[model samples]
Target: MANADARGRLRRPDGGPLRVLVVDDEPTLAELLTMALRYEGWEVRSAGDGLGAVRAARDFRPDAVVLDMMLPDIDGLEVLRRLRGDEPDVPVLFLTAKDSVEDRITGLTAGGDDYVTKPFSLEEVVARLRGLMRRAARSDTRPDSLLVVGDLVMDEDSHEVRRGGDEITLTATEFELLRFLMRNPRRVLSKAQILDRVWNYDFGGQANVVELYVSYLRKKIDAGRSPMIHTLRGAGYVLRPGD
Candidate 1:
């Protein structure tokens, strides 16, 4: 693949260089993505196959990855699954030609943090990458304070949830889902959107996974109390302040 550095224009919050990995079988597309990332002052690496991408990720240790769905050796979903198994919190953005709902859900469920369809605007790709990077940075700098909504309270640093002065226990996944909802109280979140944001994947195997988890959360957060998690039929779930 052809690689060249564009003039430096982007910088990290620490004023240091950002790093990115571009994994695509198409040489031209990979080069284009590399150029765009470089123009943002990010150190860019390119890999043309799934195996090569994995090796490159290990060697380059990028802060974010832009991966194409179709690759020569291994499928992108498999690649993403492997990557996530090794680094669950690593930010991955998928580039795909397949835009079907199932395709998007599969990509998301396979552990992609975000996805961009083919023939997409480079500006949107950059914006999505920036958002992923910002989110990753925020995850590392969580505040010590508690998040409160009505009678519910969650300790950010401790991963502790409580309601009406009673402690509640939740699985890691449930905690994350609840945290995301509480963070955006009253916002209408469709199941697909919840899967994308909270699960960091699209709804794949079971769209009901969101509903099941919502039930799990309710058992913990509101089993003997008034319901705060509302299910909007044909829509999704929302966390308000009361029953």
Candidate 2:
């Protein structure tokens, strides 16, 4: 776990500073996290309650989220649902009680990517978030830079995707998942493979996040049109040109 310095600062795939949303009812704790993340050269936003967290997420569009399970309102689990209900399967790191195994289990089962026990160091939080971002980053240097399968096109260098000449807007995480699908074309990517490549965090075998994001992609890429993304029952997901 090397320190993030100005010279070696990590950035988002779009070449912008990484964004993180910190949700905690304690103003002092939230401010400390905010300052630490900012010092690492990333954008930071904070919310004191569940509703505010959801609102902040919409306005901030953060790349990652640091959530506190003990919230002043609505609790952390509900907030996680609200956030996922929106868009972009942003990696969530839950802060929980040190002795509460149940809190840890519930958080991961509810779609949190990772967590840190209370009374933890700020350095640990920063390191964990950095790891998530590193795994989420797109492979920018590709020999095929441009991927084309039928009417769908993806430009890795430009971070752009188009289907049937319609430009499709995607979040950083969505773009990474779509890019993996396009790169493989008709190949069936297993849940394990997708998790390792798309989300490197340990979710204790939890993989519904894959299903959730795929559903999101379908609404945008296949809604009211031929479906290019397909689920193969017992297999995994396969992306092909729509008929």
Candidate 3:
């Protein structure tokens, strides 16, 4: 049964409990996660292996998933690949003991939405999950709000971007960052703010990843054209139409 905490309900935009699928082979950890999520008044389900995770994901149609990278059956990436085949937009938070930068990058580059290293604080996990779910809910409810700055336009509903009549393909993270920028055009955004909004402050205050992704975005959105994304030297980045 779903937990009924009137004050603690994790409600979706539709006023229903946010459904979460927790996938972990560690039985105790899985139960702990289930309990914690339930305590937030979220509808929670559990699966002990990759195959079961995929099956439960298909059946439950969860709004988000807390997935472990290690699994007994197929591995978490494979399970994620399978789950995404049905619902590509569902946010996924990866849980694992892999603490290396390469491991985190591998998970993110492999289409996982967020990565949480093991030996983590449950509060941090809950905060990250809440952020991801809020992002998803915002996109789902306001998909038609097309963001535009000069010749650049982003259709959040269709997940399409066009610049001066040229189409651009962006990864999910890139799209989200761009969307954030577009929503606040002409305003400089600090690395801290961007980290808080885009990366969820999970990087221990390191800003290199933010710079790296900004460079990545510049190459795609500004290369061979008048740049719309500008670095403000010791300040932050801003999106503005070139004069």
Over the full model, what C-alpha lDDT does candidate 1 score relative to the true structure? 0.76
Pairs with backbone N, CA or C atoms under 3 Å apart (clashes), candidate 3: none
What is the lDDT of every predicted structure here? Answer: 0.76, 0.81, 0.81
lDDT tens digits, residue span 51-129, model 3: 9998898889898899988888898889888988999878888887845666566666676777778887778778888
Q: What's the CA RMSD for each of the models?
A: 7.4, 7.4, 3.7
For residue 11, give model 3's deviation from the true position in Å: 2.1
TM-score of candidate 2 to 2 decimals: 0.57
With candidate 2 superimposed using the best TM-score fit, by how many Å does residue 54's alpha carbon deviate from the native? 12
Estimate, for each residue in 1-243, the C-alpha lDDT of model 2 and write its tens digit.
Answer: 112336767766566878899999999999999999999888999999999999999999988899999997799999998998895457788999989877876786576766788898898799778767674543434444788988989887777788988998765556778878987999999877887777665544446667767876787788888999999988899999999
* Residue 221 shift from truth in candidate 3, angstroms: 3.3
Instruction: List candidate 2 segments past 4 Å from native.
Output: 1-21, 26-64, 67-128, 135-144
Instruction: Count the clashes in each prediction.
Output: 2, 0, 0
Off by over 4 Å in 1: 1-15, 145-155, 158-180, 184-237, 241-243
